[model samples]
Target chain A: MRHPYADLVAHAAHLLAAAGLDGDKPTVVAERLVRADAMGHTTHGLALLPAYLRDIGSGAMTRSGEPAIVVDRPAAVVWDGRRLPGVWLTARAVDLAVARARDYGTCTVVIRRSHHIAALAAYLTAATDAGMMVVVASSDPAAAHVAPYGGKRALFTPDPVAIGIPTEGDPILIDISASITTAGLAARLTTAGRPLPGVWALDGEGRPTDAADVLSTDPRGSLLPIGGIDHGHKGYGLALWIEALTQGLSGWGRADGEAGWGGAVFVQVFDPELFAGGPAFRRQTEWLAENCRANPPIDPEKPVRLPGSKAAAGVARAQAEGLELFPGILEALVPWAERLGVAALDGRA
Target chain B: MRHPYADLVAHAAHLLAAAGLDGDKPTVVAERLVRADAMGHTTHGLALLPAYLRDIGSGAMTRSGEPAIVVDRPAAVVWDGRRLPGVWLTARAVDLAVARARDYGTCTVVIRRSHHIAALAAYLTAATDAGMMVVVASSDPAAAHVAPYGGKRALFTPDPVAIGIPTEGDPILIDISASITTAGLAARLTTAGRPLPGVWALDGEGRPTDAADVLSTDPRGSLLPIGGIDHGHKGYGLALWIEALTQGLSGWGRADGEAGWGGAVFVQVFDPELFAGGPAFRRQTEWLAENCRANPPIDPEKPVRLPGSKAAAGVARAQAEGLELFPGILEALVPWAERLGVAALDGRA
Candidate 1:
C-alpha cells in the first residue's frame, strides 16, 4: 500500500513520541527514516523503526538530552552523543558544522556513542542545500563483520562514508562502504536462501564464495572489501582511516570495550567560498558532472548517471506519487504503533 | 647495482640542478623520489625523474618561484603553484598545514597547477612524525586514463588519495588510487608485451579484459575503477570526491583547459590533541593496529601486516644496506645525466 510521505512521517513521529523521544527528536528521526526510503535505501529506511522503538523501550537510546560537548575548538569539535538517537544526533552535528564553517571556513564534528545512524545520504542534503560540501563517516566498533585485507577473522564493520557536493543543478550525493556488500544485504540474501550476485564473500577457510550463509557459519566467513580479493588492500586502508577519523578522534571505541548497537561518527563541512569563490567551485563541478553524463556507456541503451541522480529522481517520484513501503516494513511497524497507543499508518487521516 | 642512499640522492639532485631546478628544489625532489624507491613504489620513484627533467627542459615546470597565495584563511588556503615542482610544493604545503593545524585544530591547503607530485606516501611521514593525521590527494586535470563507472571513455586520472595515521609504533600509511590499476602499470605491461594480472581494465566496447594494449587502441579502452565492474560506482564516487577536494577546492581544473603535465593537489592535517587528546587517540589506534596484526591470516606463512609495515621494513633495509633502482630506471636517466653534464649514478661518490 502506498502512503503519502507526510502521512508516513507524521505517523512514525507520533509512534516515536509515544515510545519516549522528546522535543523534536521524534520528528527528526521520522523525517530522516522516510527520506531514506524515498531515496531507495529500503534496508535502512522505515524498516528500522521497530528496532529503534525497542531500543527506546530498553533505555538503549537516550530519549531527551543534548550531546555532551567533549571538546570545542574554533574549527573542530568532539561530542559525546550519550547514546542518543543517531539520526537526530547526526543531523544536529551536520547543522552545527555547517553553521560554524561560515566563520572558520571548515569545521569538523566527531561524535562518540551515537546509536545506529541511518542512511548517511539522508543527512547530506542539509549541507548541500546550503552550498557547502560535507563528509560523513561512521563505524560501529562493537560490531565486526569484515576481516582485514589478509586476515580471516572479522575485525571491522563495513565503515561507510558519504560525501555531498553541490553543483549548479542537483547536488551529488555519494554513499559508499569500505566493503563490497553490506551486512544487511548479506543477511537478507541468507534469509532468502539466495546466493550473492558474485563471489563477494569469503568462506571460513579463506576461499572466495558466493554463499551468503557463510557469514553465519562457525568461524564465519566475512564480506570482501571493496576491491575484492585482488585489490582488497585499498579497501582495508580506507576502513582503517574511517576508524581513525570516527573512533580514534572521538576518543572512544572497541579498545574501550563493547557498546551496544552504537557507533562513532565523523562529520565535516567545508565552505568553498572560503577557499575559492563559490562560483568557480560550482563551475568546475558542473562541467565534470556534465561530461560524466555525456561519456559513452558500454551499453548504448543505458546511459551513465551521476551518483545521486537516480536517488534524486526516486525522491521526486515518492514525493509526488506517494511511497510504497517494502513488504513487511509497514506491517512490522503497525504492531509498534498499537503497542504505543498511536494511530497506525493505515488509520491515518 | 645497489647504490648508497645518500649517493643516489646527491647524484639525482645534481642532475635536477643541472636540469634547471634552483635552491633546495632539486634536493627536495631528489629525496622524495629516492624515498619512494626505498618504500618499494618503484613506478612512482626514481623512474619519474627522467620525465621531470624532460618537463623542466620543455619549460613545462617552473624551476624557481614562490606560489601565488590565492586564498589564505585561518584554517583553509589555496595556492596557485604556477607549474612548480609538485614534489617541493606539496612538501611545503604539508609543512604549512601542519603548522597551521596546531593553532586551528585542522588545516587544509589546495594547490592548483602543480607539476606531478611523485608519491603521496613520501609526503606523509613529515606530518605523522609530528603526531598529526594527514590526508593527501591529487588529480591531474590534463590527464584522463580511468573511465567513469558505466562509461567506456576516460573521464578521470587515477586520482590517488593517501592518509597517514600515527600510532605508538610505525604510523599506518595508506596510499591508494580510485582505479583498479594505474596508467603507468598499464603502459609498462603494454610495452613488455604482457597481459595484466587480471581483467582490471575495460575494452573500448566496455568489456572486461586483461589486455593492457587495449588502452593504446584507437577508441582507447580505459582503466576500471577500484571496485571494477561489479561495484565500480563506489570507486567512481571516490574519484569524484577526490576531484572536488583537489580541483574543485583549488578553483582550477579540467574546465579551465589542460595546461600540460600537471595536477591539482589537496593536503589536510589534523592534530589529535585538539580533539580527544593525543594519548586517547593513540591508545585506540594502537589497539586496532595490534588486533589487526594478530588476526589469523588466510595463510599461516604470511601474517597480516599493516599498510605501511612492508614499506617501513623496505626503508629500514635500504638505510642499512643500499637502494636498488629498478633495472631500467638508472639507464633511462643516463641520457639526461650526460646531456645535462651531471655526474651519473655509476660515478657517485
Candidate 2:
C-alpha cells in the first residue's frame, strides 16, 4: 500500500527512537532508509530494520554516541564512528566533506567502525544537490553472499558504491554493489518462495543453485559477483577496490580482522565551482545527458534514462502518493512498534 | 620470450625519442608503457606504440609540450595537457597531487586534452610508492563498444579506473575498465581469427554474439560490460561517474563535444601517516591482509594474492628476462619504429 513519504520516515524515526536511538540519530537513520525505499531500493530499505534493532538490543551498536575525530586536516578528516549508526555518521561525514570542498575545492573524509550505511546515494544526494560531486565507499568484515573473484567461497561483502554528479537538468547518480545479486533480494525471493533469475548464485560445492535456502544456517551457498559465476574477477576487483578505500586506507575493519560487519567509510566531495564555474559544470553534464538521450534509441520507443532520473522520478512519485511498502514489511514492524510504544505506520497498526 | 624490463623500457624510450619525444618525456612515457606490459597488460603496452606514432605523425599528439596548470588550490589542481603525450602530463599531475596530499593529507589533480595514459595502475603506483593511497579514473572519447546499461547502441567509452591502498604487506592495486573487455583485446582476437570467449560481444540487434569479427569496421557489434549485456548498466553508471569526476568536474571534454581519443584524468591521493599514525595504519592494513590471506583459500594451493603483489612479481620477472612481446604486437610496431628512423626491435639495423 502507498504511504506518505514523510509518514514513512516519521514511523521509522519513531521506531528507532523507541528502540533507544534518541536525538537526531533516529531522524538521520530514518531519512536515509526511507529515501532508499522511496527510490524503490527495497533491499536497503525497511528490511534492514529488524537486524539493526537486533544489533541495538545486543549492544553491538551504540546509541547516543559521538564519533571521535581522529584526524582533521585542511582537506581530509578521519573519524571513529564509535559503533554509531553509519547513516548518521556517513551523512555527517559527507557534509563535512562538502564543507571542506567548498573551502578547498575538494576534500576526503574517512570513518572507521561505522555501522551499515543504508543507502549511500542519500549521503551523496546532498553533495550533488549542492553542486558538488562525491564518491563514497565502505567495507564490512562479515561478508554474506559475494565470493572473491575467481574463487568459490564468499570472501567479501556486496561492497556497494555510489557516485553522484550534479547537472542543470538532472543529477546523474550511479549506485551499485559489486555482487551480481544482493543477498537481501535473494532473501526476499526466498521468503516469497520464488526462484532466482538465471545463475546468480552458487551452492557450497561451487555448483550453480537457485535455492535461496542455501544461505540459511547450514550456509550452503553464496552470491556471485556482478559478472556472475564465470567472470566475476571484475566484481571482485571492484569489491577489493572499495575495501581499500574504506577499510584499507582508513585503518578500520580489515578484511581479516573482526568476524562481524564493521569497517571504514570514505567519502570524497568535490565542488565543481571551485575549479570550474557552477553553471558551466551543470551545463556540461546536461549536454552529456542530452546527447546520450537524443541518440536514436535501440528501441525507437524507449529513450535513454539518465542514472538518477528514474530514482528522482520514483522519489517524486513517492512524495506525492505515500511510499509503497510491501505488506510483509508493514506486518513485521507492527509488533516492534508496540514494544517501543512508537506510532505505527499510517496504513497499518 | 621474456627480456629484461630495463631493456624493454629502454627500447620504448628510444622509439618514442626517435618519434621526437625526447628527454624526460620519452622516459616517462616509456616507463609507464613498459611497466604495463611487464605487469601483463598487453593492451596498454607496446601495442599502443603504433597509435602513438600515428598520432604524432598526424600532429594530433605533441612530443614535447608544457601542460599549463589551469587551476590550483590547496586541495585540487587542473591541467591543460595541450594535446601532449598523456604519460608526461599525467605523471606531472600525479606528482602535483602527491605534493598536495603530503601537505593536506588529501588532494586531487585533473588533466584535460591529454593522450592515452597507458595504464591507470601506473599512476596509482606512483602515488602508493610515495606512501599515499590513491584513486584514479580516466575516460576516452566515445568508442563503439559497450552500450550504456539499457539500450543497445554504444554511447560511452569504456572508462578506466584504478585505485591503490597502502597495505602493511603490499599496496593493493586495482585497475579496471568499465567494459567487460577492452577494444584492444577484442581487436587483437578478431585479427587473430580467434573465437570470442563466451558471449563477450553483442550484435547490432543486442543479442549475444561470440564472434570477434563482430567488432570489425562494419561496427555490427559492441562489447559487453563485465556483467554481460544486462549488467553493463552498472558499467555504464561507473563510466558516467568517472566522466563527472574527471571531465565534467574539470569543465573539459563536455560529453556532446566532437569525439576523439582524448583522456580526462582524475587522480586522488591521501597520506595514511597524516591521518592515523603511520605505524597504526600499517598495523591495521597488515592485519587486514593477514585476515584475507588466512581465510582458508578456496583453493589452498593458490592462496589469496593481494592486488599489487602479482604485478610486483611480474615486474621482478620482467626485470630479469625483459618484457614479453607478442609476435603480432612486434610486427605492428616495426613499421612505426622504422618510420621514425629508429632501428627495428630485432637489434639489427
DockQ, per model, reads 0.86, 0.54
Find the 10 residues in a row with the least total lDDT in model 1 chain A: A340-349
Q: Calculate model 1's interface RMSD in Å.
A: 0.8
For candidate 1, write residues B179-271 as lDDT tens digits: 988888898889889999988999988899999987789778999999898889989999999999999999999899876999999999999
Error of 1 at A227 (Å): 0.9
lDDT of 2 by residue, B135-247 (tens): 88887654456666556666666778888777665777888777877777888888788977778877777678787766664546677767876566777777778777777
**A227-298, model 2: which lDDT tens digit per residue?**
776567678778877766677556765433565545578898889888866876777677778766775556
Q: Candidates' lDDT values, in order?
A: 0.92, 0.76
Docking class of 1: high
Off by over 4 Å in 2: A217-219, A259-263, A298-302, B142-144, B217-219, B254-256, B291-304, B345-349
The TM-score of the first chain in every model comes to 0.98, 0.93
lDDT (Cα, 0-100) at A106 in candidate 2: 83
Q: How close is candidate 2 to the true structure, as a TM-score?
A: 0.94
Clashes of each: 0, 13
